[model samples]
Target: MSQMITIELNGQQQPLPPGSTVNDLLAIVGSDGKSVAVLVNDRIIRPESRALHQLQEGNRVELLIFAGGG
Candidate 1:
């Protein structure tokens, strides 16, 4: 069994499996289909890099989603 890691997601505690990437988290949270801006440790993570950015324990992540509304 693999160990789970804890991360601060959008100011809340989120538990994720080890080796989880930014893309993985987005998919898990059902946000993969939306337009989102991801930040890790205060640095912006581009869309093309989401799949390669691995999330670590105690890492702080922030996801800002864009919505279309008047």
Candidate 2:
């Protein structure tokens, strides 16, 4: 079995398997990366870094998606 870690996402706790990359989380949240931004542990993560960044235990991640309002 793969290791699992607890991460906080948009103020909610989520369990993710070890070796999971940012792309995995983006998929879970149904984001396409075009209109979304990611923050990890209070630091902004660049889009290019997502594919290479692996999630760690007790990480605080926030996903902000763009929405149009008129």
Per-residue lDDT tens digits for candidate 2, residues 1-70, read 9668889999999998888788899887778645678999989889889998999988999988768878
Kindly list the per-residue Cα lDDT of model 1 for residues 11-70, writing each as its tens digit: 999999999999999999999989999999999999999999999999999999767779
Q: Which stretches of candidate 2 lie above 4 Å from their native place? A: none
Residue pairs with colliding backbones in model 1 are none
lDDT of model 2, residue 47: 85
Tell me, by TM-score, which candidate is best: 1
Q: Model 1: how large is the Cα RMSD against the reference?
A: 1.6
Residue 63 of candidate 2: its Cα lDDT? Answer: 89
lDDT of each prediction vs. the true structure? 0.95, 0.86
TM-scores for every predicted model: 0.91, 0.86
